[model samples]
Target: MSMADRIKTKLTERFHPLLLEVIDDSHRHHGHAGWQEGGETHFRVRIATRDFDGLSRVAQHRAVMSELDDELKERVHALNIEVIPADKA
Candidate 1:
């Protein structure tokens, strides 16, 4: 599977998000640090989930980060996360 597909699948399985978008931002950051040739580096995630219903922004980010632990350490260079409650968006 592609990196974007893998990320979306993992987030869906883990959080059951109401909405999820995994953006491959590698091209935008070309020549920036950790810009790999394979385009699995920079990412921005917009996810709305009930799992984040009562969580603070930091807590929501932590939860998502934890779920993406392996990817964060290995393939991903940066993750810009937007965690929103399902009802808000």
Candidate 2:
């Protein structure tokens, strides 16, 4: 699967989001750190899930980072995440 798809899959399985968008933004960073010809190094994830409701923003981000730890270590160089509580979506 593509990195964005993998991220979407993992997030879906874990968060069961009301809204989710995993965007591959690697193309925007050409020639910058971690950029490559094929472009799977950077991403932006916008998600809304009940699971995030009570969490502070920092906690929410940390939770997502932890969930995608392997991807970060393996290939993904940067991830921009915007999390929303389902009710707020």
- The best candidate in terms of TM-score: 2
Error of 1 at 32 (Å): 0.6
The worst-scoring run of ten residues by lDDT in candidate 1 lies at 80-89
- Which predicted model would earn the best lDDT? 2
lDDT for model 1: 0.89
- For model 1, the superposed segments whose C-alpha errors exceed 4 Å read none
Provide backbone clash counts, one per model.
Answer: 0, 0
Over 1-89, each residue of candidate 2 has an lDDT whose tens digit, in order, gives: 88888999999999899999999999999999988789999999999999988899999999899999999998899999998668878
Name the TM-score of candidate 2.
0.95
- TM-scores for all predictions: 0.94, 0.95
Q: Clash pairs of candidate 1?
A: none
